[model samples]
Target: MSLLETLAGKGLRREPPTRDEALALLATSDDDLLDVVAAAGRVRRHWFGRRVKLNYLVNLKSGLCPEDCTYCSQRLGSKADILTYTWLKPGEAADAAAAGMAAGAKRVCLVASGRGPTDRDVRRVADTIAAIKERGDVEICACLGLLRDGQGERLRDAGAHAYNHNLNTSEAQYGDICTTHDFGDRADTVRRSRDAGLSPCSGLIAGMGETDGDLVDVAFALRELDVDSVPVNFLIPFEGTPLAGQWALTPQRCLRILAMVRFVCPDVEVRLSGGREIHLRSLQPLALHIVNSIFLGDYLTSEGQAGQADLDMIADAGFEVEGADVPTLPEHRREAAPARDAAPLADAVPVPDAAPVSGARADLVAVRRRGAGTELPPNA
Candidate 1:
């Protein structure tokens, strides 16, 4: 049987892909890339049909992180001038979350940047969680760095439906990305979240100068962790971060990575996160075939296509948003919406070289224009 056939069969059998099989999927030639996506699509449709889940991110707290994660603009000793802030008031968080909920997001991701949440931080977030839950049926997923002992349970009590702690990369490559913490620290958090009755939502970031083996390691690790949601972020390579100049992702490679994650963790919700616009460019629609979930609007530090554009993309691609029917594109959106990157440079969010993001918290109102011209070859 062809590899695709075997993979499709494995999906039907609810069997996970082996290490060799996953590597082969990643190694798929550029010419045969669409074929792999098609096979992964088959698996996706079998489990999720043409329904896409819309997720929205509420950056409850931004920047000022103590950890030194190389890819994160929020990390310590970083020069990216992204917004920094202390915790938002519960009402503010609820309001931010309401924007996403109104946009047809079925789940809202509440993210804060820090090494871990203290008891006070957890309680503060828990209050926000409770307020958001009180507002509607949206699922609450908290991405507040690491959780202290019992903090997950407290979050559960506060109405957090899921917990997000991305493994970021493989155990072997963990040190390259951030040395303040290790891979085991992340894994243990996933376990803690799962143990506390929050659905474990973990994932990885591709194109961070890791080997193919590192990608495979994370895919299999997610399976072992049995996470409910997997977000595959293509590294943004923000201009001021340590990885700033590392623009090694292509749309095809990004798709292949999503397909591999699907094959390895067939049933989980694989989301195309972060660098989709800068990296995926025109091919974003093709990704819907392999991933069931996506962030609806702006990402934590970067901007995404407007929510309407995302809804239109899902509808145009013949997929329905999870909680709402496919919306009809008005005449303006009917012809492709303007590429987010085409926006003027002044509109782009700049990760400034500064102290804690806390300094720029008030500048959140300064919207970055999503412009074009950032793509470079993997070697560039």
Candidate 2:
């Protein structure tokens, strides 16, 4: 069988891909990109069908972060010219979340920037979660940096359904991206959230000047974590952050990364997270075939396409916006957690980066100018 066939068959059975198989998929040529997407699409459709789950970001707090993770525009000591603000009042946050739910967001991701939340911070966010839950049937996912021992349980008790702390890159290449916390710190948080009965939602960022092996390593690690969702983010390379001018991904490469994530963790909600508008560009529609979830409207530090445009694209691409009542995962996955075995990354094989994307439009790396912190209407 072809490599695609081998991996897709395994994915259909909810089997994890070997690290070498994942590396080979990443190494597939631009000429075979469509075939690779087609193969991954088979697995996507099997578990998710034609449904696209929409999640919205509510930047409960913005900027002024203590950690110096290089890719972020919000990190300390940076001059990204992005919006900076403290916690939004619970009513203000609920109002912001209501704007997105009106536009068909099934979940509202409540995000705050910091090393971790204090007990006071947790209570504040829990209050916001209660306020949002009062509004309707929306799911609340908290991304409040790392968690203390009881914060996950506290959020879970407050009607939060999931917790997001992305394993942003591979364990091997993690220090290259951020050093305030190590890979173990991230993995431990995911485990704590899972133990707290909050669905684990973690993922990775591509185009951070990582090698192909580094990308493969990220996918396998997420599988081992057995997360309920995998958000594949393309690096936005904000001009003021350390990754400024790092426009290394083509639309084809973005699709390959999504496909690889799908093959590695087939049953999870593989989301086309931040930077889809910039990196995927005209190819965004094709990505829908590989991913079942996406953020609606604006991201935390940047803006996505208009909400109506996102809806129109889903219709144009022959898919439906997955309903709020619909569960994102397969019945088996939602019924019970499965055991996950780690797949070790092969250190001997290092694949070079793809050639630089010519005419990578720097204009697409826009700073968020409105919504949460501004008087303007939220994008959704």
Candidate 3:
């Protein structure tokens, strides 16, 4: 068997590749790329098998971020125009969860923008989490900026099954993306979430101008941190962000990154996060050969492949979405009827606490002109 196959068979942690070895794999030929993915698929099938976990993300608070993350559309210093809003009330959050469940999502993620969650923010999120859980059958994940003391525990008590705080990039490359926070701080949050009995979901962004060495470092870091879930994001450049024009990803490169993550973190729930449609495009089903999970519905501040299209892609690829039997609301919860609005930028607002997100959060707003360049059909 080849080195890649051996690694996949033995499991990720058992014979993890060295940096040099990982580089060699990155330089692999296109003909071998599918083989690499197939090998990783064997490992994935061994653990998960055609079981694709679909997650839905609700941007509880739209823009209003305090940090200056270079890759985000909602960072403090961004010039890209994006929406601005505060935290939604508990009822509104719950309603979104119900919609997600109806849409066949196994979990609903509550994401807010800011440097970190304050005491009030945590309490409110916890309450909303409780309400969502009470509605039944869906897992809850929180992606607030950072975790404060005891906040992870409170989230768990309130029925949060997982907490997502992505490291975004390698330690060396992290400072280049966001100076407001350190890589260590992100690691600490993941550790605290794990300690608090919440499954930690973390991952990195590929095509962020990082080196192959940087990617290897991130994979190793995720393994070292014992993260339960890893999200591999491709950088989707926005016109007003610092890295606005930096779109260096092709489908092959994206597939390689997913395969690499699977090789390094075999048992973890490797997810295909943002930029999949833009970067992977028609090859999205191939991504499932490596990643066992995906973000369904929508992403924060960006458009994703349509839900039905994603389902079609998965079926076409010979895989099935997990938890298709889960019940969900027929229509998504919305604050108001859909209307035309300019897309919101990353640095638009400086973290405002809106209102309880439960029943009062407005209907899901569609950012006009945001989906223009991507391959996804309009209105998806």
TM-score of each: 0.86, 0.89, 0.85
Per-residue lDDT over 153-221 for candidate 1, one digit per residue giving the tens place of the 0 to 100 score: 888777777799999899999998899999999999999988887778999999899988999999999
Ranking by TM-score: 2, 1, 3
**Window of ten residues with lowest summed lDDT in model 2:** 342-351
lDDT of 3: 0.75
Per residue, candidate 3 scores C-alpha lDDT tens digits across 1-380 of 37676667666334576667677777788888878888888878766778787787877887668899988888887777666777788887777776556555677898998988898898899888777766665667899978989888877777677799998888988889888989999999999888887778899998789998899899999989988789999988876778777778888988988888888877778899998988787788889888888987567876677666666677778887665342211122112112212121111111112212222113465321252233332221
Candidate 3's TM-score reads 0.85
Candidate 1 stretches with Cα past 4 Å from truth are 324-380
What lDDT, from 0 to 1, does candidate 2 have? 0.82
Give the worst 10-residue stretch by lDDT in candidate 1: 342-351
Off by over 4 Å in 3: 12-14, 324-363, 366-380
RMSD of 2: 10.2
Clashes of 1: 13
User: Each candidate: what lDDT?
Assistant: 0.78, 0.82, 0.75
